[model samples]
Each structure stands twice: as structure tokens, then as C-alpha cells.
Target chain A: MKRNDFDFSQPNKQSYAAIVFLAYHFFRILVRQLWPVLIAVLVGRENLKNMLFWIIAGISVLVFVFAVISYLRYYFYIDNDELVVVKGIFKRSRTNIPFQRIQTINIEQSILHQLLQVAKLEVDTAGSKGTEFSFSALSMAKAEALRQVVLEQKSKILPLPQTSGVEKISGSELALQTILHLSFSELIRIGATQNHLRSLLIILAFFMTLYNQVEDIGVDTDQVVDQINEEVVYFGKIAIIILGLMSVLASFTFSLIRTIIRYYDFTLFRTNDGFKIVSGLFTKKQISAKDHKIQYISWADNPLKRLLGLYDVYLKQASSSEVRDTKSISIPGCNSKNVERIKFYYVSPEEWKDLKNFKISGKYIYVRVLYFGILPAIILGSLMLFTDFKIYSLLTALWPLLVYLAFRVNHKKWNFAINHELIYIRNGIFGNYFKALRLYKIQSMALRQSIYQRKHQLATITIYTASGNINIPYVHLDLAKDICNFVLFKIESDKRKWM
Target chain B: MEFLNEQIDVKGLPDITDIQAEKLAANYLKVIFITRGLTSFIFITGIVVAAILLKDISVTIRFSVAGLLIILFIWFFSLSSKVFNTRSYAIRQRDIIYTRGLLFKSTTIVPFNRIQHAEIVSGPIDRFYNLSSLKIFTAGGSQSDLSLPGLLSSDAARIKSFIISKTAQDEEE
Candidate 1:
């Protein structure tokens, strides 16, 4: 299905619309580099104006020229089952990616691209570092056609077993079977329930940066602080309450806007090979992963999400060491039934039924409290006794109660299980999290014993996978050994591909 | 799959601690001492120079610096020997285990199937002593999971080739 409109026989440059894309990137870098000076200028730093203005203008001109040259120089073509990319203006660099090595071809469309009816294509390889190659701007039709060709070539190279029986359908038909979509109300709920502490930190960081910049421009921050303190004293408790409410409102609004922009029109579709997720508003993104490539499935729900009956499910795949986070796709707003359906798709019901649950030793609670509670309390208490901060010692007294609560949570949450095919772990600090992975997917296993653990005949077993590490701590040494051996046996004997 | 229902005998399973580990080369201790001596010499020289330049500096400060240096020297010497004695590595049919550390000992086991690559590297001092270090990398992280230093160059090369072959065999299966 080669398009006659765009010649595939020779190396092809991205559409001229790519110049706009390049210019935007160049402008972003320029703005980031010159932001301090720009802020200084805005703050009425008169002496530096002429110099800064000339410097910024010169850089902008250079960036524009470079963007044009880069757009002109970049070209790509497929030759003998390899995608060859020739780029760079002054120093030419060529990258050849074989079809078998291409892990995912992601098509993204920024607001500018949408306006121009073009798409950006990012090709990711199994390499651990970053995106292998990205074509900044291509016609929407051409980008989709190239994606199809690359995928077809990749299938020919690897020959996926599960794709054999499903009947091939056109692209339009394939996009129709959406597995999940987030409603506006669901998005609002997610936004409202976001971690407020994280957003507060971000807001604090922004103000801190601005304060630093103002100080650099010779503004007397001490005077400003004095004025603010006097105002606070004058306004008293009402001022404090108003400020708190305003900050909360600001954080909530920020979260809401972020959620709307990120999850707008989010959709997941099932294809013959695997699943495809399309999301984002300003910059649309499409990510697809095959069924067999999924290494594990996990879901987590905090107290707020639990109240809203929402669960965020993550499907992890074998990823490179550097970009492990990018390989997993998280689907928010999944109900219990949806979670079970996805679990069933990855693991058979028979295998799931065979799982034998095991709880960690009760001593784990004592150990955690000793390490995370009493140790800190001792240091703080000793500091208070030695120093003038005697009043602060009262905080140390509260550690025992905190430690008891932590112990209770630890004892309740730490559970693991193993079936014939998969291992399941349930853990979390303040929320419930569940992870399940096939035994064969584990790359390595280690049975470790600390001095205390050794004395108590307890061991910690760590299973390493490409995506992350799973630790089952404070289990009987004999049980840990048996589990380690069984995992190793399964890994060695299983003939199926782990990825 | 049939083994899923069967009771696994924990005693019958292979234990990493049971493996007879081979100690690093004797010359490795000499390399460690030389490096430590170089560092100590530089540190002592710096203190002496500072004392000489600041003549008005208190005698108490000089004496305390000397005392601290002595204590550090004793601690380093004692711990170095203990660490050297404790370091050992064992290569099994399916995995390699390296155990080290004197006070808080740790043993890292990396299976053949998990190893991304293996390399033999020799620093200037290692080259002088005809020794090399074998580094085994995995997809787990940026750093090599296991690095066994102070092996004769030939031994390192032989181990590297063996690991490479095992990795190839694992990949084929």
C-alpha cells in the first residue's frame, strides 16, 4: 500500500512544515538560556538592557538560520529492512535501525501539527537510552502509512505467534474497538484527588526561583520579608486562613487544568497484535505494545481513588535500563471488573486459581518500627536533650504512636503469593498496590540475610526484572530458598520468550 | 508445570553460601596498600604544609591532626586486610556469586541468562601487576552488578569467554 503522492524509492525529507517545528524547538532552547536575563530586564534592570537585547536578537537570528539548515539537511529512507536516518547540518550523522530492533513507532501531533495537518513520528528501538529517530513533521497519511510498513516489516522479521489467527482490518476499523475512555466527570475526580503536596512543592519551587532571581537583581528580600511579616501580624488568623484557602484553590485549579490537558480524549484500542493507547490534548500521543511483550501487570489505588472506585492499572514491558518508566502504559479509571478482565487476558484463570498466598512474618513490623521510627526518635531526642531545643523533645514522644500505626499497616499490607506461572506481591505504605508477573520473566533472584535476619532464620528475596525490582522481605529462610529455586527452575525450563 | 504441586526440598536446593569461593590474587593486597599509602602520604603532606604556612596555628591543632591521621591510618590498615581476606567469588554452572565487605557483608548473584555483557578491564596499577578486573553487566541498572578485581589477565579473559558462551547459549534457548 505504498502511496504514490510521496515517493518511497528515494530518501525523503520531512514536509516543509518541519521548519516550523524546528524553529519552535530552537526558540524554546533560546528562551530557557536567556530567561534569567529576560527576567532581569523585566524587573527594570536598566544597565543591562542594551547588551541583553542585542545578545538575544543575535541568538534568535542564529537559531532561525540553524533551524532552516537542520530542516533541510534531515532526511530518512528505508533500505533493505533498515530505517536509515541522515541528519545534522554541520556534522552529518547517520543512524541505521533494523526492523527487528524497532520496539515501538509512536505518532504524535502537536497543536501546531494539527493546525498544519501533519504528524511527528518517533521511532524507539530496544536500546536503553532514548528515542532512536524522530521525523518532526510528516503528512498525517504518510506517517500512518510508514508506521504500517514498519510494523509489517517487523512482523515479518520476528513472526509473532498470537497474531496469526486474527483477521486483518483496515486502520479505520482497527481504531473503532476502544477498550476504555475516561469521562469528563472521571477526569475531574482524578484531578481533584491528585497529590496536593506534590503540586504545593512545585508552586513553592516556582516562587523560590522567582525570589532568588529578584534577589540577584539587588532587591532587598529582607525588607520584603519584614513588610510581609508586619502585614501577616496585622491581618492575623484570617489572613493565614485566606492564604491557605487560596493556595489550595490554586493547586486544585492547576491539577484540574493539567488533568484535562493530559487525559483529554484518552482512548485505548485492541489490535490484532496488541493494544494501542491514544491520549493528550495539546500534543496527541499514540503508544502501542504487543501482548507477549508485557512482562507484568500492576494496579494501585489510594484512599481517595478507592472512594471514587478508580484503579490505575499499569502494563510493564521489557525496557532498556535507562528508559524503564516509558515502557509501561498506565490506564486510570479502571474498575475492579476491568482490572480482572485485563488480568485474565495476560494470565489464564486456571493459573490464577493455583496461587498460594503467604504473609510475611510479624517480626517485620517490629523491624520496620525500629528502623524507621525509634532510630529517628533517638537522634531527635538526644539532640533536644543536648541542645536548647528542649521543647522539640515532645515531638519525639509522638514517634511511639506513629511507630505503632506503621507496624499495623506493615503487618496488614505485606503479602506475597506464587502460582505455577506467576508471582504476586501486595504492598503499599498508605494505599493498596498489587503486582503480578510470570515467574519466567524474572531475570535473577537473590536470597539475602542481614545479621538480625540470619539470627532469626529470616531472609529477604529480591527478584530482578527489566522494568523494576520486587522484594519479599522477612520471610522464613527455608521458604525464601524454596521460592528462589522454584523461580530459577521456571526461568530455565520455560521455552517461551520472556519479552 | 507438574512441579507446581510438588513439595520442594529446601535442603536439596543449591545454596550460594555452600560454594567454595576462590580468593583474589595475593598481589591484590599489595595494590591496595600502595594506593592507600599514596593517599595517606598526600594527606599528611597537606597537613604538614598547612602547619608550616600557619606558624601561629595552635600546637593543639597540630597534635590533634597528627592524632586523627594516626587513628585513620590504623583503621584503614586494619579494615583493608579484613576486607581483602573476606573478598571471594564463585562461578556456578548457571550464575556467578561475588561476596565482599568485612562488617556488613553482601553477596550478589547474577545468572548467566541475565548478563547483558562481560568485560575485562585493567587499570595502570592492575597492568603493572598483570591483573585485570572482570565486570559483568545486566539490564538491571547502569552499574555492573558484579565486578571481581585482582584476577590474572589470562584468568579474567578465560572467565569472560566462558560467560560470553553461556550467555549465548542462554539466548538460544
Candidate 2:
């Protein structure tokens, strides 16, 4: 730890403690895939209890033996400029990851790992040929030593890297500056600010999917529903209200627990040339998003978060979408000041003023409102007029009204700003989302228009970055073209590397 | 760092609004129509046969279905012509632009430096006509990639080499 550097040129197997992790992983996968079968055998009509017990014991022992063998087989070493991993028993295979392509080295610590004072190190590379292997168990000092070697600025890799993912989390000492830290109160506030409505919607969707699956499996869902309905009617509206309240309460509690587990004692630090975020409770994770690799920075607040004076900030790094999903980092509960600091570190947010501003046409909502709102409303109205379902009229009136309100909110929140260096998009409804990107970072530009938009002289432009994309919908056709051309010019003229 | 945020004069910049984009080979239109026409004819003919043979479907409905089959062919040919005209490509000094589509029209631009790779491809019919397409890949992944079909094989090869050279120059820089 004091040296901050060590050698791993000699091949060595993982720590003996790795067997515990390997066995845990093997058993977890077994239970995850066979839980239903396990339950069926246990509760089934057949009395083959002795056979089942023997089978379980046999599998467990076999799993332990396999884990031990795997642990013994796994060997890693640094050979030249590549990190080499040689593993597998019968079907031998080896992987070589160059230090240049190794984009990020992250650390994770489960409860067991923490108790054993060991950590899991996951190595993520840039492309589809990703080296997404991990050491299931390694001493913290050894993992740190490996990271130190790989992340060295002057290490032998082709065309020296501009920004390295030099990082610090809880243990290994490295040069890092504390940017922000969340107190216990802030964590609670963050949990409180989570959108319970969204969580509830997801839960409802999950249950609907589950019900459909059960119905497909020959269950009499309608009969079950009728019985539930009868019970509900017998209990009356008060009981229904209580049930709704309980579900809402359950969703809120679920959101809070998830927030705490994922972001307990969150800390953001500024490394020499990048941003490092360390978080989690039982499975501690630490990742660094290098300055040059970060393609876009976004921050937003929901209605609740806005009330609490906090914003959730996300740094999208350069990669394909699949890799980006694992690479990107989101920091919740950053106040306006913290967000500004983060934004400043990436791009000068203050320089956004005096830049050209563009608005998505008011007609943007017309297609949505007409198709999604009014058309359905009109269809339902006619249906109600033709049929005896009088309650449908109320529904017909209710839908368009909600859509129109949403339209009003969305219209207020849609627009973008751009200058020679940066593109800032402001969007969202009832809250605010700001996505800031550098013009030169865009990998491609797409200008789109539907027939209706062409008739109205409107167009949309999508600027694709390595991480994701920013779409400005229904701007003036000419404006979209101009923005596209300007971005292309910037990309061509600029010599700076996007990654 | 000097004047990095200078106000961009968009008017002075190169505009792709009315460039003389190179149209796809004319005979390739035959390729497009031939393939689509064959598929449409087979399906429509099958439906026509079904319409004529089915006794339970009724006369008015059968005749209307028969009428729609002809109209569908007419509509398909007309739409295909319009779409064929919309497809064109232009190469700038540092980037390539592809203009395509009729209903949901789109124009995509990919800078050479940003392009990960480019390749020339030809289907069997395309090979018969000595026509190939150039696909430009970027780090932005598949959706943002551009594919320009209906080019002469020589032209496709030329464009692929040009793109490769440009990207290689960036690496050298």
C-alpha cells in the first residue's frame, strides 16, 4: 500500500479465499436456475425425499470440487504490455488484454469479501471484443497494485493515453481530491426524493406481465380475479382504498431500501485527470470516468428532487451502448452547487450564455396530441354515442384533458442551446433535464423529417455520441440542417480526439 | 484556447442543402424493382388465387380484394420510384453525406476521422449487375452507420479505399 506500485510479471493463481467466492457464485447460479424445480420436488406428491436429498448433497459436493479446481486453474500475469489470464481445465483457453484497451478497472466488495478483507476486481475494455473478466477474490493490496501498474501514465502502450482511469475508493492510497460526500441525512433525503410513482408503475407492469404468464400457463386468472373482486366488494370501498394505500406505501419503502443499498455513503472524488465515484452498501463499487472519455454530462431533478434542492448527475463515457450501460456512472442527490461543479469540471457551463438558442416547434406536440390523445378520445366518444356504455363518455373526456396538460408542460420544457464548442439541451416535464455535450464529441449526425414535418417545414436532428445520442425534435427544418452542417464542420476541423 | 468559443457564422460554413449529390446507378433501379416486384407479384397472385377460389368469402368482397391487388402493385411501383429518387450520396473533403428516404426522409453525415471502418458488399443480383454497396461503420454503433447501395462495383471499391485512406491519415496524425 505504501509503495503504491508492485510487479505482477510472474504468473500466480488467485488468493486461496477465491474458492469461497467461486463456490458462492456456483451455488447462487444453481439456486437461481433451479429454485422452482427444487420447490416442486420438495412439495410434490411423490415421496422421494431420500433421493432428492442425495441428489442435492451430490451436486453441492461436486460444485465445491469444481470451484476448487477452477480456483487452482486460474492464473494471471502481466506479459509485456498485455494482462494475460490463463484458465480452464479440460477446455483450456487464455485471454490477453492490452493496457491501452483496458478502459476502466473497477472494484467490488461483497459482504463476504469485506469480512475476508478481499475484493473483486473487474476489468472493462472499450469495444465488443471486451475483456470483461474479473478476479473473484484478490487481496485489496494486490488489486490496487495491479490497477496502479495498468493505469500508469508512462506505461508501455501505443500512442500515450491523454486521460487515465487512475482511481481511489476506500482502501488503497492514491493522490485524489475529495469533490463531494453524502451525509446520512443527504442519503435519506435522496431516498425520499426517489420517484415512487415510477417505482409503482414498474411494479404494476411487472405484476401484469406475471399475471399474463400465469394465465398462459393454464391458470384460471379470470376466476381468480372474480374471487378477488367478490372479496373486494364484500369488504367495500374502504378496504380497496386501504389496499391502494398499502401498495403505494410498499412501493415507497421499496424505493427507499433500493436507494440506500445502491448508494450508501456515496462519495465523489476528483482524480488527477478524471472523476471517481465510490458507492454501495453490501457490494461496494468504485469506478472512474476519465475526463477525455466522458462524452456527455447530464443532470436532472424530478418534482420531488427539485423540492429537496437536489439533482441526479450522470456522466456518460465513450463506448457502444452495451458497454456504456456498465461504464456510465450516476450520482444521485447532488445539489445545484455540486452539479455546477461537476459540470464545470467537464465543460464551462458559465459560457453557455450568449449562445444561440433553438426551440422545438410548438407543432411538435400536435402529432402526439392528435394521435395519442384526441384520436382515441374521438374514437371512444363515438363508441359511447353508438353504445349504451355511458361511463365511457367520462373516460373519453378524461384522457385528452390529461394529454393536453402534459403537452403544455412538455412545450414549456423543450429547447436546446448551442455555441461553437458546446451543445446544451434543456428538456423534461414538471422537472428540468439539462444535457451538455461538446460539439466535437459527436460521432455522427442524422437529419430527419416525416412527410407531415416536411409540409410544415420542420425537422429533427439526432447527434450521436459514443455513449448515447441527443435528439432535438421538430425544430425548423432549416435550423436542423444548419446545426447539422455546423456540427460536421466542427468535427472535421477539430483535431482533438473525442475519446 | 485562443477564442475557442467564437460565435459560429453558420452561413459561411459549407452547406449540404443543395449539393449535386451523386445519384445511384440507374440499372440498380431495375434491381430494386425486380426484387420487390417479384415478392409482391407472388404474394398478390397467391391472394388473387385464394380470392377467386374461396366460395364462402362472397362476391363483392372478393372482387374488391381483386381490385386492391392491382392497386397495391401500382402503389408499390410508384412509391419505389419516389424512394429511388430520394437516395443519393455526396463526399465532402472530410466527411460523407448520404441523403435517403421519401416518407420519413433522412440525411446522415459521417466524418472520415470518426469512421471505424468501411466495406464494399454485393448481393447475388448486385453482382450480376456489377453493382455493390459501401457500408460505413462508426463507433456510434450500428444505427448511426450508413449504407449506400446501388453503386457500380468500381465506384464502391474506390469510395471504400478513399475512406480507409482518410481514416488512416487521422491515425498517422
Candidate 3:
């Protein structure tokens, strides 16, 4: 269908498919709300049968009526260059978003929407807390037409140079220029390399939930624990080893399944304007941010990922105050060459090569040791003098060694650099993290000195960007001041757009 | 990269310490004393009420607690006075600099172009004294990056207008 076929001037309701979507959502919510009653019916099956039937029937009818009412009440259209949405059942709200203020119009299609050939449209405005307006379901044709009209109006206001001819290209032709694609094996590698501790904790939490549910069903947990203890004693040390190995295997499998589901058919494509990443098995998320909007780019590789030659690259864009994780696009399973390619797009290749590195002051090591080691040691030693935890006193003896190791690793990892308009900060111990941002993108800068730092003539400089703030902690006061001045000078002089 | 290779003359650059910032309003000290005095009065009243409620408590213990609170309040007032004296702000052509704190000193520089908005607000006590506070916000975060309290209402309005105009001009560029 042609884009001009839709009558955008008149106020209109969404496609009838929206009612189906709303009904599905409302039904899900109703089920969640009635979960306690459902559990009661499950426990007292014979006695509550009639009550449960009536309750389900009443809730289903109420949810259906509510969803239909909500669908009927919602209406949106473009009026006087503003996207106006009038919606509500009782209170009634009219949201008028000026075309010039719209930051982005995101279109998403869930499985149900895809089946119905409908899309969910979300309009985001700059300076607002979150999504300004959301239409749960709209016809695909109308969604595209609305997006084009909004973009046209935005271009009229901003006068941004159009990166034309992108729409004409077919999907297959665009796929030919795929920059990064994670194969099944690579996804497996990423899953296996994930931090085992986090996966173990997730597994533990899952079991804890089950344990709680069992307790709620009147099971004696103490009896279960006593039986488990008897089994453990009968089986002895090998039983503990077997259990540990089994838990480790369970975590690994869980992580593998999660990665498979999340990153299935992960693909990144470089377009004329910027990069496009399409991933997710069920949700099918498509994220595209222009190159200019990108404020920072960072990549990290843990020891396991390093062995497999894999790193996760993150592109952080200028975001509103919400701080949603969606502001950044993370592409895992990227090799070193892919990382270089991605960096080349954001930063100039020559500038990337000539970054002048500087190490943080060694005093950071002393401070870290004092806080992480000596203080803990003192607390534990004092506690041992009062409490009967002699084992904790023995653990106190290990603090000095821990402090030494931490200081060595911290000193080795902490470093930052500058080159032309770009500032590079690299830190982290087991995982090597590298972040780079343009100096002009910094919104503000601060130099902080604690009493201890003041005595040592050391200070910490923090540079705030739209995505997040970066800190160069425990640097020589003189050097920090010089860097701050240079950064401010660059920010004041540069005429380029920050986002 | 060429810019990094070039040497930056640290000595030639304007140092925050050397900028010679202007102090807050002359009555700022008086304002602080009044506010602190009011707070301490409330705190002492609460303690006295508690002591009266607990009839079994000895008079000596109650008197000692009161004495300790008074001493602590005096010490806090002196420390706050020192901190107030250290508070200062400087306005450059392109940015505003604010420095505060007696122990953990911090110097914040927010460029004019980066400011999202500026507001001039006066509280009851500040209004009584004809003083106002200028708050400068940035898109970098939710909190205002620079908030300078204890300015004469007129000066606060002037600064607020200047910042608003600067922000508008920056947007144009």
C-alpha cells in the first residue's frame, strides 16, 4: 500500500487487532492478580471447586469488558504538527507532543503482532522521563506512514542532512553487508565464558523460590534438612564434590540456554547512517542509532572471553533521564577485528592509534588496600577479641596478602589516555574494559579532593556524559587540573554536535 | 592526536584556586545561624519532651544529656560556619565554577552551553531576608549541578536571566 493512502489528518482509533492485544495483556494481568486465589484452589482442590469456577468466570468477564473499554477510549492523530493522544477511561488525558520535540519513534512487533501484521509504536521525546506516547497496536502500513511523517517534521525543524536511498534497499541486499554475525558455536562460546558466580547465584535463587513454595505447602523444611544431612554424612566428602560439580554443570547449562534464547541469529549491519542490530529469539528487537548520537563506545573481555578471542562492545547514546538499559546496544561475541571496525566508525583510526596513555597515581593502591584490607582486618581482629569466631581471626591474617595482590592488580589495570577529541579510559582486573568518548561530549567536569587526597596532593577528576560519568581517580592534582582545563578548553572551542 | 602531542601549558591556564571567587551574601552567615538555631531548638525540645515522658529517668542524666547536646550543637555551628566561609562561586564567559566543603573540597565546572535550565527560588527564611538561591540544571543528571544559595533576590534573578539567555544562545549555535 502507498503511504499516502492513510488519512492522517483525522483522529483515528488503532486497528481492531489492538483489542486482541489488549485482551491478551489484560487477561495476563487478571491471572497474576488472582494468583493467590488460584494457589488456594490448587491446595484445597475439592472444597473450593465451585468458588474457583465462579471467581474465574467473573474475572474473565471483567477483564474482557475493561480491555474493550480501554481500546474504545484510546485515540491518537497528528494535529497542528503535534502528535496528540487522547486516552483514559475515567480521568481522561490529552498528550500533545510537538513534532520538533520528538527524539525517536520506535516500532516493535511481538509474536502476536507479527501474526496479526500489526506493530507497537513508541514515541520518545528529549528531556522527558521516558516514552512520551505508546500505541500498543497499529496497522503496519499506518505505523510506517506515521513514522515517516514524524521524521519529515523532525527534519524540517533540525535540517539534518538526509541519509537518503536507504529505504529502497531490500533486506537481502542489506544483509550482504553484514558487519558481525554470531554463529551458534560463537553463541555457545559466549554462554560458556559468562561469569559462573552470577549463574550459580541465579540457580540458588531459583531453588530458594522452590523451597519457599514447598514451605508454603506445609512441608517441614527442618525435616528435609535433617534427611539431607544424614545423606551427606553417609556419602561423605565425595558427595560434596559431586554436588558442587553438579551445581556447576547446572549453571553452565542454564547460561547456555539463556544465551541461545537471547542472542539467536544475532546480526549487526553497517548502514550509511550508523549500525543496526537485530537479535532476540522471541522479542525480535531492532535497534538503530545514528553515529552522531553515540556519546561513548566501550568493550570488555574477561579471561575466558579473551582465551576465546571474544569481547562485548557497547554503544551508549544520548538518553533522557530514565537511564534505561536500552540506551546502549551491546553486541557480544565480537572478535578483535570486529571491535576495531566498530571503533573506527565511532573514532578516527589515526586518533585511536596515537592515544597518549597515563597511569593513575600509585597512591590509589595504598588507599584501596587501606579500605579493602587493613580496615577489614582491624574489624575482624577486634571482633575476634570479643566474639568466639576464632576462624574469622585466622581469616584476618590473610588480609595483608590480599591487600598486596589487589594493589598489584589495580596498579596494573588503572590507566587513561587522551588523543585529539577522544578520551580513553581502561580499567578492571579480570575483565579488561576500555571506554572512549569525545571530549566535546562531556556535559560537565568536576575535580574532587578528600582530606587524605589533599594531604597527598592527589585529586579525582570526573567527566560527565549523557550516558554515564567516567572517573580518573587518584591522579596527581597538577595533572588532573591540566587535563580538566584542556578538556574544558576543547569543549568550549569545538563547534561539533555533542549528540 | 596532534592536539595531544602538543604541550599544554598548565601554568598559563586559569587555576580554580587562583580565580578569586566571590563570596555568598553578607547575611548568609546570619541566615545559617538562624536556621541552625531553629533546628537545634526543635531537637532540644524533642529531647526534653522525651525526658519528661520517661518519669523514672534521673534529673542528673537528663541534665548531662542536655549539656552534651548543647556542646555538640556549638561544635557543629562552628564547623558549619567554616564550611560557609569556604563556599564561593565564579562565573566565566563560557562556564560557571562552584567550590564548597571544608574537608572534601570539590570544584564543579558546568559550561553554559550544557545548562538545560536555570531557576531562582526563595524560601521563607530567604524571603524574610530578601535572599534567593540560583539553581542551574543540566541534562547530565536529574539533580542540579550547581546550586548557589544566599544571594540577594535581585542578584539571583539577574544571574538566572543571564544563564537562561546564555543557554538560549548556546542552543542557537
Give me the candidate number with maximum lDDT: 2
Compared with the true structure, model 3 gives a TM-score of 0.88
Kindly report the fnat of each predicted structure, to 2 decimals. Answer: 0.32, 0.78, 0.63
Say which docking band candidate 3 falls in: acceptable
Sort the predicted structures by TM-score, highest score first: 2, 1, 3
Q: What is every candidate's C-alpha DockQ against the true complex, given to 2 decimals?
A: 0.34, 0.59, 0.45
Clashing residue pairs found in predicted model 2: none
lDDT of each: 0.79, 0.83, 0.81
TM-score of every candidate? 0.88, 0.90, 0.88
Ranking by lDDT: 2, 3, 1
Evaluated on CA atoms against the true complex, candidate 1 attains a DockQ of: 0.34
Candidate 1 clashing pairs, residues 3+ apart or interchain? none
The lowest-lDDT stretch of 10 consecutive residues in candidate 2 chain A is: A163-172
- RMSD of each predicted structure: 3.9, 3.7, 4.3
